[model samples]
Target chain A: MRPQHLLHQPLTTQKCTLGCPILDRCLGGAIPCNSITELVAESGSGKTQLCLQLSLSSQLPASHGGLSASSLYLHTEFPFPFRRLHQLSTNFRSSHPCNDHDPCDNIFVQGVHTVDQLLDIMPRIESFIKNSKSRLPIRLIVIDSIAALFRSDFENTPGDLKKRSSLFFKISGKLKAMAMGFGLAVVVTNQVVDLVAPDEGINGLKVGNLGCLYSSGRRVCPALGLAWANCVNSRLFLAKDDEFVHQDNQLVNGDGGDFVSRRTRRWIHVVFAPHLPKLSCEFEITRKGIFGVER
Target chain B: MEISRLPISASQRGKLISAGYTSLSSLSSVSSSALASDLRISESEAVEILKVASRGSRLGWSDGTNSVINGAQNAWDMLHEEESLTCITTSCADLDNILGGGINCKEVMEIGGVPGIGKTQLGIQLAVNVQIPREFGGLGGKAIYIDTEGSFMVERALQIAEACVEDMSEYSRFLRNDVQACQVKIQPKDILENIFYFRICSYTEQIALINYLEKFMSEHKDVKLVIVDSITFHFRQDFDDMALRTRVLGGISLKLMKLAKEFSLAVVLLNQVTTKYTDGSFQLTLALGDSWSHSCTNRVILYWNGDERYAYIDKSPSLQSASAPYSVTSRGIRNSAPRKYCSDHQSNV
Candidate 1:
């Protein structure tokens, strides 16, 4: 038997569209299946909003770039955004009137407070998927902000670091295997932390390239260092920058440009992806859902 | 070959053999500390055993009586090989001149810059230009482009390939007097087809794909250029352990260097720039810290020079430290026309 043939088969060719045409196009059609895609950003950048939007979209019919399946939303950050999910469901209902089923009814929400709890739930999730009573198969598994579970779990000792990294690999390894076996799309959210540069002198900084990544205007890197970074198949960075917008309504002529208002501009950057070029596009989060602004 | 053959104490030999390190080759890669822990011996005794094993292996090699030293080449032969090494052009005249005709094969070259400084453009240009027929003074070989940042666009590659085809046909017209050189058999589609694209999602996959390149390259011997578009993206993220990151990067660089030499192909590693806090302020430098600087045979830093894209040879053993102006034109990397001096232009990180 040709082992190469089995290995070369395109395993992750399916995509669950983000529901917005421009955003989907930016992500090369949609969130690819059989891979772990991470969303990293500071708070209020709409990482959870996007995940909520995805939970609803995954329930959409296959013709609309969905799996026509259910989603498992595992949240580590508090009080499941029930109201926001409700608002999104109403919009989803209006958008696709043909589907009479409640978009919210299909989503399975599980709150995890600690790292041990999250790890313990892995087997249950597998069993749930294997013997799901619902008509739709679970095609999406989302862990909203994976960094939260590990934030206070371990201290900064070498042994603790090793243990934390091993746990990271363990979780991701299981997630990857589940994704490949079940053909599900795994979306994990990660928070960002202020990057503290090493105080090592100029020569020290030059000895090891400890460069920093900037999001919005602040110098921040994704929470959970390189070990977690290696676990995700793709990383999407969301940033918001406050910009002064000209208040054109107050001006009678083009010269009256002194009146301005401040507004936050949000952008989604493809930090790294196997199928995407390094690209970024502006997006907005409204009551309806997240939509990509055409450039 | 066996552990018993080592000139070590009988008890130590018994422990090593019982612990399953029965051969010298198996013990070769094992560290003394690890061997000591596994065999329940002191570190000093493990070291002695390792020393004797190495000596025994050396004697075994001599007993074989091979004429040539294994994998060793004299300096004179190496010079001849280096002189004949081929280079894949970036298609920009000034960039090519400073790059010593073009990006030299059998060596690893790292090119890094800030976002949108045309690193991907240069990578794609080289991927297309590598396929330029030998008649046109090119390598006429295939290219393997490993895109880590998803920055590689097929539409952009297609456009560059079309432009490359046009350039070739135009050159053929100039060499019309030489009847054999006027045949432009390659097409834009063919150029695109010749490029094998790999989309790497994670650092592990990136490392795995790089390791797999040896077997892949052996199968497709015509692959003369390996382009890794941004090797630092995954390695720079989420890594809290600086020591492990350094060791991982070092191993990868060694593998890449070996692949370059063994396959006689150009290995171009595209890198991203990171902000470094130095002298009480943030300064933009290439990603993947200082130790990674020694990984490649050549390092080229791309930056903005008063509204013009310039590439500076930051480090190279043979090439002089110099900078040249280039541009990312619609047709891909090309020579930039001298622009009016603008003092306000600052490096955009």
Candidate 2:
């Protein structure tokens, strides 16, 4: 029997890399390639930024912390952070002059507003993979944020958490299959909510559910908490440093109306990374991207 | 490619295999006409192949199908006992002790409690525990968390990590010293596609997702647990075509149960509480309907007493339906012996 025809080899073991230098080290490699790697955090926690960077980085070749692979970035809530992404990309290109662009040519970005759109494009994505003649490779895949598409795309309106989750179950499955078949890495960002404690227990907080919000109690802890934390091969929780603790006093010029701080010291912490031995790492949001700093 | 002694094409052998005529008994019993019809081959050819096989010459082809089935069942039973596949223990030692060493694979343990009862916290803690090494009795695998409530707090995950590392004695430790909170990978994407291995499937998607999940389980084979914090919300939102609700729920439940069994992975589903209109009093209800309830081996109902206090029980299957009082502390579920809030009146009913 032909090797491909023989079913001895399982297809789910392909590993992809996210382009972040520090992250790649922590993960031992980029998010284990073909596995579903979830990046969850509260809003403004740089989840989208990480997703964008991965989309762009998946195009880089092996020598530059990338797999010379292609990627499909699905967007829902916000417009592609084009200007910021462009800035990050251009800056990386300028900094790494030796790195060429053809490696990234395979990377594709798609914006999806609803679940139907996402499903509709899945076949097309497969076709793209089928038709591509390039040996450049396609490895990383990302869903900027799945919550928006879940909330706005479904027919059974909100207020029903059960149906929302059911819809998501279907969606996640398709993405996972695509990732597995193509040996591509998947990175998805999720939103989080605060809780009002009735007492000391952690479940005291109220949070959203269904349509990918991830319930409060069952989900609230352990590196993004609950089902969100439970679903991925690995998960990472990112949070900006508390302004009071890390804000740069030098940035506080006491001018420019309410925003006078230049060094408002924003830091991203690796609140969760399971496979990597290091439980936490600190990064400063530099002009290039999240720059690794001593934790 | 070099060891072929027969002139028959491989496709022919595949056809014969699919036709269920691999053994002498079956091949002999099947008439040439029936075999021809099933195999889409001429009756003469079917008879010829059967004759060759019936000659009893050592072709190594005629094996009893019953033995094959029995072999498969035995292997499945052995797999069913894979040690890593078990329910994640809650912080409550007593509760974990009762739960067959904390959460058996192929069963859905629903943790349903009112708000402020620490359902999320307990679930998070278990997710972490499930990843602990086997010496601690954990399955030592990653956790897949579906967060609907958005209360997936990283700080709490950090706290739990800190507690877990601290609680471990020098010998019980499975993690490295440099382990920081950053090591826990967390993806907060809302898209179902990004919800780990699960897919955001519709009716058609569900079928596709199930096939993919089966394939995925076969691949990872290490995943010992799956946690759908709230399985209810998704169904309630997506299945507005109420007519399809039962069908979808049944299909999903069956697939999940099968997945748990095949992969030897524990399934911990967090359920929501619903109220009945008759008494105008609130009752905890799993979002999934009877299909899900019946499918689940263990259905737990959690309710709050307005504070950190909560009540729960193994609600169904009648095999294990005892109510237990557990508190959701910062550490995790604290199912201490029996608490004041442990209502006997509720259990008597």
DockQ of each: 0.03, 0.04
> Per-model C-alpha lDDT, please?
0.80, 0.55
Tens digits of lDDT, candidate 2, B1-349: 1112223457766787776655455665667788889989888887776665554423334432222222344445455555434556676766665454666666766677543345667766776676665655556676555544333444455456556645644323345565452243322111111114332322444345545666766766766666665565444343557758877666767787888766767777776654322353333355555566676667666654432244446564533555455654445456543545435622542
Q: Write the residue-wise lDDT of candidate 1 on B48-142 in tens digits.
A: 88888887788667654211345666677678878886778999889989988999999999998755567778898999999998888899999
Mark the 10 consecutive residues where model 1 chain B has the least summed lDDT: B340-349
TM-scores for all candidates: the values are 0.61, 0.50
